[model samples]
Target chain A: MKAGHRHPADDDQDATTQLAGIATLARQLATAPPSVPDIASRARAWRRRQARKLAPAVVAAAAAAAVAVSAGVIPGSGGDSPAAVTAAPAPAPPMQTVRFLSSMASVAAAQSAPRPDVFWYERVADETGPATESWESTTQTGLLRAADPQQTSAIAPTAAVTYFAYEPLTFAQMRALPLDPAVLAARMRATLRASGRATGEHRTGSDQEMFESVRYMLGWGQATPELRAALYRMLATLPGVRVLGQGTDPHGRRGSVIVVALPLGGVRAMLVDPADGRLLAAGASPDDASPDDASPDDAASQAPAPAATPGGPGPWTPPADWTYRGPIHYNVIFEASGYVNAVGRRPE
Target chain B: MRTAEGFEPWYAAEFPRLVASLRIATGDAGLAEEAAAEACARAYAKWGRVRRMESPSGWVYVVALNEVRSALRRRRLERNHAGRLRAGHAPPPADPDDALWRAVRALPERMRLAVALRYVADLPEAEIATAMGVARGTVAATLHSARRQLARELAVLTIKETP
Candidate 1:
């Protein structure tokens, strides 16, 4: 670390370094910030208050030296979810994924809602948050028919970048087993039940059904750190798999532990038990596999993604250095496309 | 009151500059404007007193700066700090300051106040003291501590080259 106070170094050099840092800082401050009209109005409202004492200024000299560049506000969604701020999500447009909302109709909560009503999901601990789409409102998440099959899930926004204790299975271990989907499902069930969690019959979403007529199941339970730790160990035993970490479930299962793996194309995440090592929630990546293969769309029907803005940041690569920025908050993920549509500050 | 003539033109002339000031103060232009607006509102309400002041624009600047400080403090205090702390412990990407704000936001109320006022907002020690209601000496120390903590945590960040 530089000394806390350097003895009088030549003022010129010291001044120069400070100037450059300030200049660079000013350039960055110019990004287009969210245009929140309400916040603006509220601030203006404060003008009604009494005169408070004045404060000193950042040196005027510094302001000029600080800005090598200036900022301009622009229009268009960065589609940069809060996650994009924390970690640059790969450059892929948000897929229209709400179709999985119909899968919710089959969920017990959805099945119980009043007719003319949709699901009734809430933030498990902090119920004050937005109506959880997958578990609650159709407008928020589209419509999910609990009666439908298992859904194709992308990583839910709230669950991504989050960690939990997990039982991981290594690819080597899995290669030795039957490795069939039923066998995999049974292994998952036995593992979960042992960890004080339970799994429901796997269900499928319309998209998942169309994917390959594969039988996919979905379930939920509480996830704890201890459970996650166990999941980490167990998942390491599965062949062709590696557990990265864990995350919570969007459906509000605190006991649900998430696991990350590189099974096929890109890094895929799976929710598993830290205690018994059962898979709970899982998501696919277009990187590991082709987006074309993953999509249920008839190529002819899908629209091309919007073009990138000109002279904007690069074709959406990670910040040369991944700097965690914020719009840091919670996200609502669409199951069909795994695209995050909405976000709000973490509620009290 | 000075009938609004003394400063109306100046305030209008300084709008863009003031916007820049608030922008830096709040990290986001949108938030900065809100703070600046609040400060202006306060100025407007007290225009009689402000009109007599040496520099009415300075008065507005002070108010805006205070609003910036207060808003940031509130956000740090109210935000979910747990996830932030956990993320802070993780390795930072190449640009530490980009990620530094995240960890800074996760800090306890006082620490966050000290850090943002000093660095993110880049307010001077005297201004921070005035904004935070602390002694100038305390602002220096607070700034020192905040910098130390961030430097320690982001030791790995500065080393990574930009791709």
Candidate 2:
């Protein structure tokens, strides 16, 4: 080793001896090395699994890069370096984006959803906050249920209504939606168009509406495996869908993330387990605005009210008015999800 | 044809040494295995290109180290260090009382990776530089720093033992 400190070259001898000692100790640490055949098999399995998950996006990206080079949008080096060849290209076209999502949908559809005799329970272990235990009744009700009565009181306009009367799609309602991607996308567009916020005050456009709608549906936690796959396919068909490549969920399950660009420079990412149809986690962050432009502290102050003018509707607004307005920068780790015999019981 | 036939022999010769180096780097056998397995899998995926590289082992080492570091960072974020160390998967080394190994473990991740790769894997300075994604000069300096720290630690132990 080079003598990094200002010292005589003779001191290298003593350092070498000490390094030898460290080497001896490190050798003892490996008493039983993993077998080559074992590792080779495991490695092959991992590669196949990752290829199964990411092949669609990988192909689409390569194809897009090729097109970009041919069209003179990006200069091609034609070098032998794999890095040069596989460097992520610019965002793919809408059709390619839809195809990538369809691939994910196909993977999801192959997995089976859990069927519980009692309730749909989820255990969430927040990285930085208190752990939460939530269970939703399998049977859908006309009125939404609140975990905390005090929270309901806070949202209600008056004391006369003790519980919040908000409404979300029932499990039956979600299951009734068309499984076809194009049909689902059209239905979502119409839902956004007819909503009061779409044309009335907020003027939230179809893109932001679709983003919120997907998050809303998935967060319900009662949708069937097929419905969840349809949701992924629908989001894939939306504009500005970008694959964020392979990522690990908060629980350390490896998966790929796809993000949707939202209005007012926001982006929502969904971490889907490609092995199964499980939605591992979901998160959102505001647009990549500089701190000077749109700091988290200045969000509400900077956001103009969504009031309408006489001439036309106001500019498009963020999805802040939704019932589940996720934190500006938060990751919800889905630790456990399955049907259980009782609310407090975990699946066997 | 010979190169393709020789691949299994090459893998067998390299796997243990690589795992040992990573085990020292990560101080977790399970993590070492996981990272090494993933790297090997990736290498297998692109063997057409990887085998032609000047140092295929260096490529595998770089990928495996990255996986381990990311896993460590994520674990640190999710739980306390004590909680992680208590995990049943990473057993205490055989020489649990060895101060030299303790000092080695205490070294920063990069320095540990450099030391382990050089000493255990017996990688040349150029290969170590490639594996660590650093200049050969940087690898030399890191190893130097690690040795100086270990020397100081051993000297203290000697003085204490003499009394």
Candidate 3:
């Protein structure tokens, strides 16, 4: 008899009894499920990501239409038959990066902001030794337990307020950042320009600087969820940003990676957890050489090859050897972060 | 033609069962929850189309399974790299004392998946086939083989305990 088909009545009954015991054991393993609000937030993030992924195709079609109209070859635009008019090639859209950031924004927006009196505590680890823990309060008071034995612990007076790239911001300034992406981007640009003039630095308000500023803010700055979301949205709009697909941090945590092409050379890669919008790791590689030319000594060059774009014609593979080769200069992973009531207290 | 209003209850009812089934299938609590939540999120994102399907739960099961598979693939690659760098930092093995769980986990991946979808998710053979991307007969055969193997394992355990 067929496996699922009924055989003798006794044999069917015996199988049913065995299956029941297995089902009971399986059901015993069930734990409490995640809350609905959490899943709903993820759904919103997924929707935003889907929208961003479609943006490139939409832009390409619009560009094609504009070219057709200008050429006077569009059939409906009172022009000749559309024959051999070629549309200018559209720049590859950073679909995965945009989607990942958009998802991060959604996840960030769903989180509760830190309380007024609470300190933002974080544990960070580098490629070297043990993890170090730090706690920074809004009042610019904090404590740091460094991994180095010589200076193991210290009272940090100005931990909370730091530069968002070249533009310095106090905790208050970070909290008061505009929630709208365009408005925030403009404000960041203005601040960057002003700071550049004050410091006599010629290169300010560049996309690379802006990208670094956003990365710093998202990584260490104590911005509100609204501001964090806004920063992510702003980052999505920046040029020269590309998704290098998924990768694992030093601590073996999985995350999606986004790389920003530096103005001078090479790329800055950041790994972020899409589930919670947390910055897992950030590093930079100084070589623009393709993977084929990558030296075997390059240890941190474990980035996955370009992934196929979802629902697109073909994979949006980065220029050959877009994967960074050579050791990452500033590789660091955030082990944990949370809010605590006091400077010395760690999150439970 | 179900509206977004209809998704709330459906999600609430199905999410736990999906997680439980996935937990059994993958033998990793964290992965199961993450995959199930992601699948439900995807379903909610495209509810207009998913709600109209013949089996929304089946679709969710398929998506969750795919997520688990992708994550496992990534983990394998990461393990290879981690092995070269560090000596021993692998994830903890699943529980060894639970004979039933051990038997289930010992089954082939496809058989384990079939059993989980059938027994834990309480899905019919047809839906299990759809979710697993196998024909119905294959699912039936896999489940039958799994049940027979599980029965023998449990019987030996029982005999050992009888002393």
Candidate 1 residue-wise lDDT, A125-233, digit = tens:
1112332223322343222222112442321111111111112222233233333333443455344233212111111111111111110112222222232233333
lDDT of 1: 0.34
Candidate 2 pairs with clashing backbones? A265-A287
Evaluate candidate 1 by giving its C-alpha RMSD to the native, one decimal.
Answer: 26.1
DockQ of each: 0.05, 0.18, 0.18
Residues A106-193, model 3: lDDT tens digits? 9989988866555667777654455666655555333333333344343212333545544446767776778888888778777766
lDDT, model 3, position A18: 66
Report every candidate's CA lDDT. 0.34, 0.55, 0.62
Runs with alpha carbons beyond 4 Å of true place in candidate 3: A1-15, A57-348, B1-3, B74-98
Q: Pick the candidate with the highest DockQ.
A: 3
Evaluate candidate 2 and give its CAPRI docking class based on DockQ.
Answer: incorrect
DockQ of 1: 0.05
- DockQ-based class of model 3: incorrect
TM-score of chain A of each: 0.20, 0.53, 0.57
